[model samples]
Target: MKRIKNGIISLILILLIFVSGIPAYALEARPQITKPDLPFISAHRVIKAEPVYRVLADDKLHWYTTSADEFNYWTGLKGINNDGIAAYISPVPLPYTVPMWNMVKNNAEQYFVTSEESRDYVIGKYGYCDCGIMGYVVALNDAAHGNAQLYQWYRGATDYVYPALAELYGLDDNKWDADHYYNTVVASISSYKYEGPQFRVWSDASTLQEIDVLSPKGGETLTGGSKVNIRWKTMIPGGNISLYYTLNPSEGWSVIDEDLENTGSYEWTVPNSAASKAIVEARWSYEGIDANCYDQSDQYFSIKLGVGTPINWALAFKPLAMKALLAPAAPSNLTAISNLLQLKPMLYWQDNSTNETGFVIERKSTGSYEKLAQVAADQTKYTDSSAEAGMTYSYRVKAVNNQLSSGYSNEVSKPVFKKPEIVIPQSEPGKAGQVNMVFTLDQRDYSVNGVTKTMDVSPVSLEGRTMLPIRFAADPIGAETVWNGTDRKVTVKLDKTTIELWIGAGIALVNGVSTPIDSENPAVNPIIMNDRTMLPMRFVAENLGCTVEWLPASKQINVNYPH
Candidate 1:
């Protein structure tokens, strides 16, 4: 009886193993699995496969051995009906799919996957069992390989993957409760895409090297309607190039030409609109990517109105013709005068032409010409107060306009004159007021009280007495001297004193008292020379309350006036 019972236990264990190998639906009724109407899933029909496990709406997990037909039925039903029950293989792991579903539901309203083809491609590449985790892996691989098309497709599908899965699972929130899974997937893709240098080439046209504008740089004054050569340099060849202009750098870009080749230069006729602030932009493109290489002017330039004959608007299609303007004529009749009174040099010129902005006066020293001063257009004279006495200076003047300068005028040169030095001795107190007068020999130009006077006869020394014309010498000292032709005598009058003297006389009368002209030497007397009365300067000056001295080495005579 014991042997028979053991044989039955063994037989029962064999039957249990056989039942577990068969399809679960063949033995008992199974719960139906439903699908959700998500674009990522609906566009890509899940392939039928033998189910290895099952997930229920209530979070119940089950393992099953089912045929391909039963799995297909569940997959098709689950794709369209959100019954919250899914049957999938063990290859489609639940750990990743649950979290991915949660992410999609939270972000469904804000993000979307628009490309149906991309959804099918991703589903075909990575099985639809855990579609969310499959998409994440495909996106990372595409980004790492710099596959721009595939990367964009996967990025778009991200929005729909998790939310659609959450609907299929019949859960308001994600089963895995992952809050930032979507963002983490997106950030990882972006980081991996930018890791390689070639990523920019596939992703962004702006990241390509830019073209450089080589000519018509900022601040250039270009003539309107004139042909100008616009130049640029770029690494991208055999690409489409275009030119654009704007009055303001911020906006208003007008196309100059769009069918240009990237051959570095293009000839363009300037427009009629005169713009003081003009900017130009150059664009280069390869294939269909515009702005592949782009550059613009560093700053604003200027466009001036054209001159001369007007261009035909129909045939030429250019702005008004611009003629080059000439500068103002060179200033003429340039003259320099040495001012004896002010001890400076004055420069004068004639403005022979109009439209002159100013005149540039240059002075030539020993070697080179240096800019002296700038004067207004109407001004014709300049006073150089810094001129040094006894130095020669040459000067020239040029007329200037807004754009150019005329040739220099005829140069004029002159030497400045030096003035003589004078000295006066202080007088002592309690003594008769006396002054001394001295004059340099052969120096006819002299100034007294700021007025220049020329003497009829220069001063001379006669028998050791310095002599000068009585009228010329006495007038400066407030003494009046008169000549009598009939009497051949002269009279000198001062304050409370008078002097009378005849030509060729050794003696003279002072205050009606007869006294020798020179008490020390009788031979020294007053005479007439050069048709003027000559007198002993010392005697005459002393009689007029003055004193005198002679300097032989310098041929100068000293004069002192009493205080």
Candidate 2:
């Protein structure tokens, strides 16, 4: 009778495996369970180092694990597909272990605990209920023995796990590839949050923690007097960090903040200076070791001169009216700012409406404002690359939807400025008895009366104005030139015209009358080049009764003076 009973039990086990689709060989020995010997803990059976498998069903990720006896006895299991193997421990604490408690609110939002205080605080404050302990994990990173770094990421209310640190948002040290994760999360839900590295656990290999700089992210054109958020991330243990910035790499670094807590972010007020190649660095040091670990921007960014003042966003705002169901409220705090990179004017405003499809931007042109562009809903900023340099423009933004549109916000104007370009008018060839001179940009050799001549300093374009050595420019055109070392002034006399210009000055005197060197570009003025005085080619030559024309094909400037 005992043999018959054993035979019936064996037949039932075989039938269960056949029905559940769990292979018979999958019935491995159950994990050895151990109860915590601590006196404070009570009424518990906690499994240690239990193998856990992640399964997908009903369009949601779920964690599944069971003992060997339970797996053998289970029958007709559906929607259970083993993706990969993972490990977990119990609530009971062990040596070099931390208890990971399960907390739930609406749904499971976060897991992978840090301390009992944190768990209890969330439970009491966030209305989360304690769901008992999930498992224990290694407290510190173990490098000698290979172990994987588990990452916890969540979207909406469901928390998911990644086998490796980089798997979380496809991010690695100095590399940010959020496109795949963004698409996945955005398609499924609206909100996504990243919970940084949790406890280290056993795996095939150990991942080295690194510090990664996340922003200014290179190629950004930041303006002076504006506050910028320098952001970074690190998995290294808590230590004192320092932040530094450099306008030019060869000039060394200036401290933005020193001995700051490793908070991963800092607010910096940009200096009132312009730089084409700017970099930011974040350094982590512990135990008085300088340069222990550090990371900087992967590529250089730019900081340009602007209105050296912060925009009072609150003061710039205009009153808002109640929103109607058909349309959103008008945008507020519209302001246009100028930057040095490409001289593009940046327009910023506050999004005041929730139902608008998009905002329409208009620029004042000719006699009235015209539509410039339309950006998607909730977009409060726009860059006007089409704005002509040296031209002042006014802009306004308004909310719009399919059915209706909101009123335009308060208008803001900004005068865009860019590095000037050499401008020469179209002119006919010089007549006989005229001195014709040709100078190519960046070329030291020029021609006077069709004869080749060499100059110590090259003719170049600076701030959109053509610059040439005063002697080379005026002497070839039958103009007598004099330089005043004390006043840093250059005086050119040709026939009855007299032109006087001061170095670094935007205005020049022509025939004793004050005149701008270049009206279109205010920054166009005289400068010193290679220990020689350089004057604006167009301003000096034209004032001396000469005609100037630009040769685009060969980048040559032609000056003709009637003799």
Candidate 3:
């Protein structure tokens, strides 16, 4: 009777295999399956080195293990001795797994297929082979989740199992090939090699966590200086959040707010500058937590020229509106004065407009106004060092903002006169140690060691301070000047004192120490004009052991040596 019972059981098993259209030999070689010990049952399970099974779910392959000891070893979960358990596993590759899992999970729902159907398909085709079953699961999951690359990941294993299954099912080989499943599976496996001994273990399932921008997503035209509310969504509960923006992707990020609470929304005031392509970035982090996430706008948005418009404007009104809002008020009290100390004419104006971005100075020569110089809004004086001697000129001043110009101010006229030649007494033949020099304000000629030489570029007053040509002034005091063309710097050396100044730079080095040009004395900076290097007369002259005196009434600069 026992022999009969065993024979009946064998017959039932064969019938089951035959009904499922799978070969009996495929199940005969299957590995013995065993349940794991009890210790592995936990919210998060660990996996160690062991032969584990991969299961099919919704046509995707997932890690699963029946060994509790292996689970405890991998995930550090403590299991009681002899405690038997079974569970599905989540295999996450450390470090190499990109942080795009949140995106995958959010999109995975659309590709979800019946897990039962996928399991039945695997059992019907590949019988009970663990790897083959998992391969089918992975292929189905790939198809459902739109993960073409993942399908390619297990294509090799699937290809070996597919032909035999088709033969058992009695499906036409020509139709199967025509359907292109065989070709597709073959093609998918081409890019990848099957790396055996793949990791598998059971653990607590992880939830998808990500941040998404709800509003102002992209393609919106926003105005500068206008207030807007930025909205976002995240699975994380509460954490520190910050906002950032960038004009271009390659550039560094500019922080919009650093200490914002993760309240899902922020009120932001747009910047005043206009940009056609802009991106907004949001970052979130928690104290003492390992999970930190960030997101950026998927597409570029625009910051346009208007101050308070959300919609793109009509072409005709944009130009007019931009002009009206940005134009500064005209400057006033424009004056052109002849300086006897220098060959150039100095112009001064009253900055009458509070909103002026900058001042533009224009000179009229031959009845047409020519732009001479543009100065910062705070600057009220400019020297026309390029002006030729013995020429009459008319000057006007105007204010500007964002390339918009205001009406010209009252014009002022001045006549440039040729300076008189200065004569100096010759130095004593035996006196070699001491040098003496004198320069008068508005005078084109300076005396060196009691001898005078004509100067091509003269000393001039700038921002109420006198600037002199360094090459001429320092040479008279026995200081040597070296020009570094590569660095565009001028080095002056005189008796243990070394001064370094760069052209168009505001900082100077006095005896190897950095010193800024005095703000109150704007002329202290070294300037280059028409190939001549000029420096502040007081800074260079006083540092070299000379005393400077100003004759306010006569507008003369007097420098005495050995003081």
Candidate 4:
């Protein structure tokens, strides 16, 4: 009879809920929030010296005497999803800690203080009759104590979760009834603002790693040459800070003020140029850790020359047609094969222009010029099979695009040698201590002692000279290469000779004597391409007593050293 009566009571409760037209799922418990949405905790002050209390799973404000007890309550109650609470992972494991002082204005309002500047600002800005630090909460998080993060939330306030909750609760401008627990009465669902895990406190003292940007938060327009006060909240103390701004990331950052004292605010003069996209950044690096604690403007800002004035941009600056202003550069290092290995001699030249439609090849036999053939852009080698065997031919190439054409390259003359005069060197057997390396132009793969290897950057031709990366080209021949970044110079030591050349310098020092890197073309200098340093192969090989030969048929360079 007793069990039957208890079942009847439970059935009446369910019948009552259904009669009220309430959803069944509303009776379920709230789900757990495992991870925090924001990186760090945020601070909110409706008014100032009210002590912010940590609301535990019991739905009560608990202020512990010891930080260890506070941490114990936090970790113990963290897993319990009774209240909407979670922990955040800081970028740096051990963060700086400071004391949070509870300051009171009068017998009426209270203000909590973390920074001294903020403490003074409220005192001066707002009338505070009784201004004094009540007590300092330890905010240090280190290895000695168990690292625990402190979180803060506002009661009867809305910001992050305000919009969604306001609509659901039918809250107006002056109506906020949600408590710290934020639980529902009829339904089991609750909506509360997600104030980020505010303070990083693991030590006996209370402190935080939170730096908030205060002013120019986002979407603000200022006139050029106007003074604006940039403000931020600095939690970490005793370290220098740097301020920077940029139109865009691709344009790189420009320093506003570097290594300035952390004073929390700086007055800046807006730039004179007009820009639609501009951003500001505040970076702080503390001692004892390799971490950059920083923050950026929440949104991009705009800067105009004047307010409501339509300035003529055409009168301010002139524009030029890029294609018409610059023509394609002339091709260099023109070469034509002499030996009669095929039907016609082969012509090759280094392509010096990046923008070109095609190359126009001109041949002069006995008289003026005659059009030979036109090859596509980036083509370095061409076959002139139409040349008469007995007659000598002169070839020149010019790079041409739709809009402009480059000047003709250096003239190269090659006579079709008779078949009888052609000679091929006999293949000799390999020997120890003898090095033979072959590298093809515009190719990354090269062969050393019959073994193939790859290079980061390929060997290239510049100004009628074969250029190779000093390290790759010299290492195979038992040469030592060293780069001096300060002087922008490269040093190669082989046998008893030492060769040194500076980047963009025409002269190279050989055995304490200065000589032009390319005597034929004194303007030829070492250049950096694709982050690799390219040097004249012939100059280095000849100076090191190695035989250097260029084979046009395959566009290969052979460097041989005999021991």
Candidate that would win on lDDT: 2
Q: Write the per-residue lDDT of candidate 4 for residues 102-180, one digit (tens) a residue.
A: 4332111234455767655544333232233332333433434324544444343111222222333244311111233
CA shift at 267, candidate 1, in angstroms?
1.1
* Residue lDDT tens for model 3, 429-512: 225556666677667766666566677667777656777666666765667878764344678888988888765456678887
Worst 10-residue lDDT window, candidate 4: 42-51
lDDT of 1 by residue, 471-517 (tens): 66676566777766434467989898898875545678889888888
Error of 1 at 149 (Å): 16
- Give the clash total for candidate 1: 20
Candidate 2: tens digits of C-alpha lDDT, residues 153-269: 554311232222223224331111111011101133334465545666554322333567788767899988889999988764566677777676544556678668888889998
Segments of candidate 3 deviating more than 4 angstroms = 1-432, 519-523
Q: How accurate is candidate 3 locally (lDDT)?
A: 0.52
Q: Estimate candidate 4's alpha-carbon lDDT, on a 0 to 1 scale.
A: 0.59
List lDDT for all candidates, in order.
Answer: 0.52, 0.61, 0.52, 0.59
State in Å the error of residue 232, model 1: 1.7
- Off-target runs (Cα >4 Å) in candidate 4 are 1-429
TM-scores, one per candidate? 0.24, 0.26, 0.25, 0.26
Candidate 2, residue 122: lDDT: 52
RMSD of 2: 30.9
